[model samples]
Target: MNSRRDLLKTVGAGMLLKLIPVGAFAADLVKFVDVRLWPADEYTRVTLEHAGAIKYKHFLIENPWRMVIDLLDMRLDTTLKDLTSRLQADDPFVQQIRVAQYDANTVRLVFDLKTEVKPEIFTIEPIAEYKNRFVVDFYPKYPNDPLLALLQKEDPMLREDEISRALRLAEAETNGTLKLESGSAGSAPNTEVAKTEPNAPVNSKPKFEVRRMITVAIDPGHGGEDPGAIGKGGTYEKNVVLAISKRLKTEIDKMPGMRAMLTRNGDFFVPLNTRVKKARSVNADLFVSVHADAFIRPTAGGSSVYVLSERGATSTAAKWIANKENASDLIGGVNIKGTDAQLAKVLLDLSTTAQINDSLKLGDAVLGNLGKVNRLHKPRVEQAGFAVLRAPDIPSILIETAFISNPAEEKQLTNAAHQQKLAEAIAKGIANYFAKNPPVARTPLT
Candidate 1:
């Protein structure tokens, strides 16, 4: 009798489970909310956003060059398949993408590559409005040199000469035949070389002044997954700041003996330290980060310039702005495990007093010129601990073009004519600073 009772209980539990709706089980499966692909010359990033945690494994395959990623315990869905449609014909890295259900609970993604690539795949926890994200970045096996790219863009005709000179200087320095000396803490380093002739004098003064192209690193803040501050009219801070930065670059490039290099020339996110590294790599004369400000209060309107402050932010507003800007990396999704610890330490520890002073001078010049185009947020430049401005050697400043939160300023920021005017004012300010300070000889990158 007991054996019969046990059998009846087992049958009853089985029946109960069968009666449950299939839709109830399906709802528990992870659902991909959205997918985004950002392609640029530097790298390509793929983001998969889902409502719940996901386990993934990715590997690289050769002989045709493909990347395979397996999503464990996730069902294949239409949103996951949409990744193939996002690939652009002119994408620098990827040629095609294929998605399939490899098993009952695993969705596989295969990325066909145009060339050899180094891939970094990771996951990010939910933040702000973003859900759990699985991110993949494809970088070239051999990355292009930022300095070479800058020179080529400035003048292709002069690229060969510049490269040859840089190579020769590098060789001489390595052989202990050349030494570079700076007149002061903030001045450019002067190149001093030993005589080329055998048994010649050990020290020889430069015969003439060496004037190289002046490089200014123009950074357009907030991009890709990070939309920055959104205005009431739906203007994205990333888009407007990019337009303004590009215009500023055009204006700067037109100046005599001056050239500009944009940290990013497209819609992509760059880590803050990467921006500083690019400026230092190019031996930039000045680092200008362009941004559109936002405030909780719509009444806040006007332009402001900011330099790095060691003590603390000059005001509460400055501190708030810095905190917001600094959060960009978190929103943009940096692979924390892949970050270079040494590089980060250098960026954080190397802010010098001299750099700050020079930054202040540049800020003052830019602030004065900005007042001509729009109302000044403050009569003087504000100071804060901006991560992008922590290049130990280069003078850096952040410019808040206008408060994008304000309706009037948002409309003006979207206007092309106004953008051009802002560009002109900024260019004039840079010109003024250069005229008064006179950049010294450039130091060659090692």
Candidate 2:
């Protein structure tokens, strides 16, 4: 009788298991890890990090202009409670952020906006040092135009002084008198004139004693979420390139008929597509992406230059490197599901050959100068399908300053002296390119 009863109970349990759905008893916990806010001229991003996949619904509220984000099946943790504190008072878009546990298993965030904005809210898969993330990006409805921003009406008297200060700023860096460096961008420039050119080209039918300012977009590869390649000494590639790029910008601004615009002025993550967009948006004459390379073997040392290849990568190594760099969108995290028509233009507009040819010329010019300052990784510029170099019209090139993998080279890469030398070399190379190949103005895109 007992054996019969045990068999019946086992059969009944098996029948009940078949009727139940899968994951019915899974853990009902969603751990909120941290919150980060990055405010920039382009956009302000709010990132909510969590351990597991988070379900969220975000909606915009009008009248007062606010954004409401509701997280489902989640517990508001201490880290996320600190979200309000992460907001800066000077944020261009957000006035304030309010957070609360709206109800059981639901957390809500309300962003009080100063103006109307187009919000892009999405979830990103775990990458690099980050886990599951929910991202909220706020872009102004009538976004500020980069070209307009680049062209500001300045008091004619201050223009000459600005150039002079830029010229002396480079020397000041070495002399330790660069009191107003990258951090002091808004301070009045020194009016002391080191020198001035007598005959500068006045472009676009300008009759005044002024010259056309050719914008060179200097891009420092990788930042924020993407730390980029790291050295054994704990040096980050992003920081090194940023330092060099800033020096290069200072040198360029000092020259007549030239101005340098940075894709990023701070240590914030600008998506790979966004970098190219920023350059093109400013109608930049040239695009130079600066980076420091790394290899598995610590023996690799020296610098290299790269141009986009219309076909495929010119070498096996180039292919591998290009593939790795193209994966930045993954590591940096992009809204893969959302359709970005502008970003997806795909460079299939033809005329890619002319762009690549011009890029090669620029690469050769930069490579020649870089060789003088550092050991050459290759005697010739390598060709690869670098995504960052895919601007349809703008001449673009990527420069690997040196191999951060090699210990000796890594030490040199991190040194301020070497950084300045590298910047000077690159600036000279750019000046050389413009000298031989003057940019032809094209009708602005509609």
Candidate 3:
């Protein structure tokens, strides 16, 4: 015979099991509703919907394109064909559409494109007068013939190989399997000014061949149990950034002399300290931390870049932003005291005043290249005490791709084509920076 206590316990266990949605245990809980490229003469709109409560919105806009996605707290139960058919045959802006499940809780909608375009994404929460919204907007750019050839020949396999090597390094270091250095071996260099000469059938000396490959660590922000930010459209910052990071990796792989590694590839949560550890372990030359900004104002519609903060935040606005970004661990339920205190102290002490200076220079170079491809929030790079940017040696920058809080920008961020453009711009910025500032090679033991 069962006692009252036993029955109660059994009932409670059943209730708990019921509470855990089937989607949670399954690898991917989210489903795709519809992903379509709705084009207007002025801009193109790419929309997404899924199951779940409203968490957040995201916008990714570099130059010549934009992407926005609304994250819902609900699950999806739609088919890919159902959504793809919505794209009209007459639409000229979007080149193609691709949709697939990213994970148990997320779906990816990719938009292929014919050309680059400037873009923005944002989310609007219900206010006294307005309803909730996730929006994306676009700003067209003039054609660049050189860009076409570059995109056509892009490769994803080579990029993944580099990323795999870096990940192994990161994992080894995180698990105490590897010890690394923070010295400045190969600092970015300056470029010689170009001069034009008359072409009089002079047999030009064959262009000097230089082979340089850079190892970069690309962190997709939040992941696993830690949803970085909750958007008005129920989008999780972790899932969204991861998708973008993977796309960025694909493009980076396509390049000839560059490779990228992700900090955390799946839904597992990673501590702030661990992020930098991974970058340093792999001897990453540059660290680009990708994120979608969220704010009280839904109207904020531009991307911002940040290097490490030397003296904390200089202003109230900076402080606020820092606080929000730092809160990511809280959502992910991190045991900071248990894992990071010692490493934090060591990294800070080892992170000499000079490393910060190098980081700033790297930020400037990347930002300058970014400006060439996208609309920037400010002409100068912003500084904030971002934990993700704490690597003592790596030249690191955190990019707020765009605001997920603004409705117009949010729509653009979900568009696959725009995401590709954003990826291209970032890649281009990195390439340009490296071209001018080639890395010094380490001598091998004879």
Candidate 4:
């Protein structure tokens, strides 16, 4: 009894329903830019413009070197050749340029060294007072300069996978497996601090077990403008970690005797020092940083936990985590060239021994807890000097939840239920640590 038009409309709607796939609308194609190297002293001048191609102001700094190219939401579409040609033809100090696509969202333009130099990479986001702009880092690379050496050593570029390797090396040292040390390592400026250890005995428990509300700091590494590790499918390390961190926080909050605070609340940048400061601000009982591992090869898998190591990364994973953590400074706004090299090195040296010891204990507890929920890389802990875990007094552990670079594991990491399991495991670890070795009561919670 239906009219011809109504019958055709009903059939068309049914056909459309059959053609559509579930969640088909949720996917977006990933876009990326290419990168290549260029010669310096090529571009005498560089300029940036707004969305409509309106010219914006720009400037360049010769010493403590960098280039500031300001723009208003300008989509940078120039090829690497264009960049190289500009630099080779005009720029004075730049010997050559090396460009790499850090991710879909960022590009790294390395200015090769013609002389001893320092550089900083930073950016200002669109705010009420200012507009979004990109800053170029080009500095002289000093050879064997002590302060530069220290910074370079801590610099993610120098020590890749430092955290994972350092932890494994630390474990190896404890196990008497490997006694690896670099030639210049012992000669480092703060030799005394490196040699000193906490007076607390390995077996000694806290003197007084006073019940208190223990606050734990959880730092989910890399966010916003900085994505820690990129996977094959374009799943961002920042997004994955924030998910895990939130899950961990939820689990921690449900626990009766403890509380957890995150280094960051949303998709924004948080510095390594600021993350440590957040733990101190909360008077944290412990600090545990969560991260996903990435590697040059996709074969890397398994979970690893790390503590601080002054020497270098003890294992492969430790090295990767340290490298990843150190890059945050470049993205976060600290000009390595501007920092007092001696002071930074000294602070790092002083914190190494104590942080290493505390990191071991913390690592053991977390590793033990993770074992109950999922498979571990090994039964022992690893060591590495991850900048984020460099809090002087607070015991800090950096846990590589899993290697997101590995395809199979990336699937597991992206799963919500798996993330819940991982979070639950970490929370249980924190709870168990407190139960066994209760922290001495400090100030009351705010």
Best by lDDT: 1
lDDT minimum window of 10 residues, candidate 4: 41-50
Model 3's number of clashes is: 64
For all predicted structures, in order, the TM-scores are 0.88, 0.79, 0.52, 0.54
Instruction: Quantify how close model 2 is to the true structure by its C-alpha RMSD in Å.
Output: 11.3
Clash pairs of candidate 2?
A: none
Candidate 4 regions exceeding 4 Å error are 1-211, 332-346, 349-352, 441-446
Note each model's CA RMSD in angstroms: 5.6, 11.3, 16.6, 21.3
Cα displacement (angstroms), candidate 2, residue 22, comes to 13
Q: Output candidate 3 Cα RMSD.
A: 16.6
The best candidate by TM-score is: 1
* Candidates' C-alpha lDDT: 0.86, 0.80, 0.61, 0.61
Q: Cα lDDT of model 1 overall?
A: 0.86
Candidate 2 error regions (>4 Å): 1-29, 153-210, 337-339, 443-446
The sequence of per-residue lDDT tens digits that candidate 3 reaches over residues 206-277 is 132122347778999876435666568877667767777888888787788777777777665566787887
lDDT of model 4, residue 389 = 76
Compare candidates 1 and 4 on lDDT and give the better one. 1
Ranking by lDDT: 1, 2, 4, 3
- Residue 88 CA error for candidate 3 (Å)? 37
